[model samples]
Target: MWIVLLLPIVAYIFIQIAFCRVKSQSKYLRNVPGKRPFLIFGNLLDFLPGSIVFLDNLMGYLKTYGDTILFHDGSFSWILLSIDYEFNEFLYSSSVHIEKSDQYQFFHGWFGQGLLTSSGSTWRNHRKVITHSFHFSILLQFIDVFDSVGDNLVKKLESEAGKDSVEISQLISLYALDVICEAAMGVKIQALEAGNSEYVKSIKEMCNIVVDRVFSFISPRLYKLTWTYYREKTALKVRGFVLA
Candidate 1:
């Protein structure tokens, strides 16, 4: 039993070492210079728990590797192209070559095939419809709608400020939600007024949960199988409330 367990463990270690060596060797073959990626985990382990550290690590890599760097996340490889005039021009010059990556399929559950997530001809058609709907004259007609929402937000904040130094971040978020609901759906959520309004609470909780799931190593398919009571139930309720 001891021999059997030890043999498997040893073999696993050997395989991991070999994979690391092969990945490291590939750096030499490539035209650019980059830090050799670690085996299996790659550079992901360095920033596994949070994005702040991940961003810091990426900045450090940028300092060392210059603007353009190649890195691997799990089995997925990507090129980090820092912003430059030439790169911006190349990106905006053509819609044909600037298609969404295959990795975006993972977000299907969150956004469905909506305009933000859709691509190719479907995206083009959606863009045309939205553009026509928001023509200059149409937008100009909504000036009162915009002004009313802004005034409501300023009044709400003035009332809240009398109590104590408000948590500006939370207040701003609630204000934004109220504004969007009134502007887009023609529904007043009044999230800023109620403070603990169910819709506002649910939206914030859902956003936090989604962010947590995205940063984790959990399989994207697993999110499809599992539904949190907070997100699913609240989403259904909110949708009904909004549509009503």
Candidate 2:
């Protein structure tokens, strides 16, 4: 009688283990009508960060599943609804439940409860503020600022060209940094001239760290804590240096 009782317990344990295994494997398994994602990376490994593999992945899925492809991006499931003419018309015509996903909350730790990351009433208020700030008249007034910055960038690029080839990425990043600093904060960065400015260095480091966090398989809460500390420390240093 003891043996019989032990057998049922053992069977239940085995079944539970099997179920757990299935659940873990289910994210990579292709149930939807599209090309199967990679076993481990799930169509993201090649496409992440600097690479343009996302286009190829989308094309592959389009060939197999038409316009709309349903796939799991790691643990997060997404519906890749194409921007075809018919789909665009359908989307615009509907007054439906169009809200940002829960996954977007992951960015809140990095961007704070800011407009881009926040939701509901907070986002609504942010939108109102931004709309007022970016009125047509305001944008028109900024046109001369844009033209002056553009001329400076072209002149700088012309000056930096070597006999061989230049590091295009670094140069473009500096140009963009300069433009953003001037446009947003009304402060000149001169990142190309100083190359290793504290603010530019910190921003580049922070960007790399954020990208690393985005691709990590760790829990979002833990990642948020780690990134928040790094971001705050780096930001304080940058702010101090900039003010000084």
Candidate 3:
């Protein structure tokens, strides 16, 4: 009796997989040669976890294949990826395609309607206003800010000179972050001196959380079910820092 019951369930699983495989191959995308997708998983099984490896996987795929490749997530959504530099440059710079990708809207919760995520006229208006800030004369004002951050970094490196080689990547990243905060935000965070800042910790956490959601097989909104409490907590911390 146990064998009889298990046989039907096993058969059902195979049937579902077959159905999903068939459905995954779209009429338009069928022309592109790529990996076969699985039910509710798509090509997710083929990717390494986290944002960094996920991007590497794409570049690897592009290298293995040609410029155009088909990619899918779960059952419903499909992406026609293009690696051709000229084609992508035209797509990005063309006035007609001003809207950011669907994934960008997820960042709206953290960044608000600023340049990277905003769309339509709001983005155009912000672009116009912020473009002037990049003028040569205006940018010349930030030289002092760069010098200040660079001087502190040199002093920090000199202090650690005789010791074993330090990870300059993190140290320089912290310094660059401090420069951006001072120059762009007009706030002197002095993040290098602060060492472990609550804002820095929270923002880093927020970025990782966002990257996970972006690559998730399911909808990004679904992350709220698991991370709502944590998301709110971090958002409050970021808002507190910005508001202050």
**lDDT of each prediction vs. the true structure?**
0.66, 0.64, 0.75
What lDDT tens digits, residue by residue, belong to model 2 across residues 1-244? 9999999999888667755764675665455455455754555564465556766766776777776565545433443556468876886454353356546655554456767666667767787689788767777766776787678767778887764777778877887777777777788878867887877777776665555544444556566477555664665466654455
In model 2, which residue pairs have backbone atoms overlapping below 3 Å?
A: none
Q: Which ten residues in a row have the lowest lDDT in candidate 3?
A: 44-53
The residue-level lDDT of candidate 3 at 13 comes to 91
lDDT of 3 by residue, 214-234 (tens): 557555556566765477566
- Between prediction 2 and prediction 3, which has the larger TM-score? 3
Once superposed on the true structure, which residue ranges of model 3 sit more than 4 Å away at CA?
1-34, 51-56, 66-70, 79-84, 159-165
Clashing pairs in 3: none
lDDT of 1 by residue, 1-244 (tens): 9999899999888678867765675666486546666756656665564466877887888898877665655443433445457866877566676466545554454457756677888878887789777668867766777787678778877887777577889878877787778777888877877888877776766665654553454566565566653465455465567657
Segments of candidate 2 deviating more than 4 angstroms? 1-34, 37-41, 44-70, 79-98, 167-169, 224-244
Model 1: what TM-score?
A: 0.67
> Considering lDDT, where higher is better, how would the candidates rank from best to worst?
3, 1, 2
